[model samples]
Target: MRKLLICILSAVLLFFQARAQENIQLKSGDLIFQNLDCGPLCDAINAVTQGYQGNKFSHMGMVLLRNDSVLIIEASGKNVHLTPLKTFLSKSAHPHYVGRLKPAYQKLIPTALAFSMAQMGVLYDDQYLYNNGKYYCSELIYDAFKAANKNKPFFKLFPMTYKEPGSGAYFPVWKVYFEHLNMEVPEGKPGCNPGGISLSDKIDILGQYK
Candidate 1:
């Protein structure tokens, strides 16, 4: 009985959310950026990077417009999976931003989404390393577009930094995180983060998704 009530509640919530977002006009393959308020780790992430117009973002996901429902494809939790747009929005407390590809690059959306779909169950890359057979949020988006562009880089990658800006000292959160994993911080490793990708010239920022 409890499970049935939960299902009914979920349906009602989705119905209202759909109506609320009626005018969003989002398209498939839109790059959605979110400011995650997930404590020190997220704080460290924002401290080291800057998003479009200097906004700080800690997470990202891609939009998948399927019929009347809007979903988000992201490498989060234990695997890569699709989440309802409502669910994705609710996960972050800060405003979410959307980026749509310019007309010239719209053709790549299908291939990019197709690549993402094929990676449905890949494990999350908590280590934040490139090509280690796992997918982190931004890395999944990076590789999907790269695959769409025939394995060419559709997005740029840079050496990752885990240090506090201007201090050149490693953030304490990252220090303990890597230490717990028995690995040194992978600084200088090739990586692509949400903040960096938000500044790409290939897409035009459509402002806040809300």
Candidate 2:
């Protein structure tokens, strides 16, 4: 009877340990993500930009995923202007550049929008681009290290949740700041305004920090 009780207790402890390892929480900005699987995701992004050696494209963000929770870390870029998608679309010469976006590129849309709003610290440009005053859209990079990890579990390129009607909340630095202060996340109509939804109309995932 004693041996059986010990075995049962050991099984219960193992179950709880497994559960504990399933998910990780990134509550603070200083937390560094070491378990992030970057192999497969980076490969995927590289596949899209074959032979491209642009400096802007080389720089990327870091993302960590443990179980359901995912942490996105936005690092400062060198000489890169964070350009918004709407601004780019408005100025785009192509006819088929609005509303109609490729699914594969959706993961990049928010970062691109935020980049647009981010103040341009330094000036950098690609050889292909001609504009001296405005920045190009191709300079943004999405690091896919999680996708590359075959052995470890990783979140999808675009991490999303099903709690809300559409995609969860999205905000610029200002909006995120306000939200962090325990005030309401600015919610107005979607349009070309600071309070408006810069990205998709979908709701934002609650736990993830901007």
Candidate 3:
């Protein structure tokens, strides 16, 4: 069918794009930002948050250089795990952007990555609550650096808003989302998101994967 052919063509383009990014000299603790295209819920998340340089991001992961291999440590799927860089890029609909810590903060890389590696197999936090013993994408990275900073907060957590910014009402998607989880929305809970971290002054955007 024509639709199937179009899908195949798209896949091919993404594959080559992922391959091209191999030239980028990725280092451990580098952040990889992504727009997951995960539909309405993702759109709602971005609606309340913004990224650096006018970019849009909803998911993020840290680069891990281990044993001469490149991997991305992200809290996705059922738990925290390392995904190959190519696989990570292929999952994104937008060009992958990389972020590196400033010189002073680069020293935290080892300790931060160590903390993250120890969290392998941790549960994914669908509730999006901070310090809930489950790791969400950005929360995992936030806490890793926090631990590296001797329990001091690295990226600041804002009062999470699941509602429309100025209208003072919950996004219908979030209303249904939490209702299905059988819990009230944690509107004012302290939390961090990819978009928020993207705007952090501690790191410098190093350009796109292309």
Per-candidate local distance difference test: 0.92, 0.30, 0.92
How many clashes (backbone N, Cα, C below 3 Å) per candidate? 0, 24, 0
Q: Residues 122-143, candidate 2: write the lDDT tens digits.
A: 3443221222432222222221
Instruction: Estimate the overall C-alpha local distance difference test score of candidate 3.
Output: 0.92
Measured with C-alpha atoms, the lDDT of residue 126 in candidate 3 is: 92
Ranking by lDDT: 1, 3, 2
Per-model TM-score on C-alpha atoms: 0.88, 0.19, 0.88
Worst 10 residues of 3 by lDDT: 15-24
Which of candidates 1 and 2 reaches a greater lDDT?
1
- List candidate 1 segments past 4 Å from native: 1-23
Instruction: Tell me the lDDT of model 1 at 3.
Output: 100
Q: What's model 2's TM-score?
A: 0.19
Expressed as tens digits, the lDDT of each residue in 62-150 for candidate 1 is: 99988889999999889999999999999887778889989998999999999999999999999999999999999999999999998
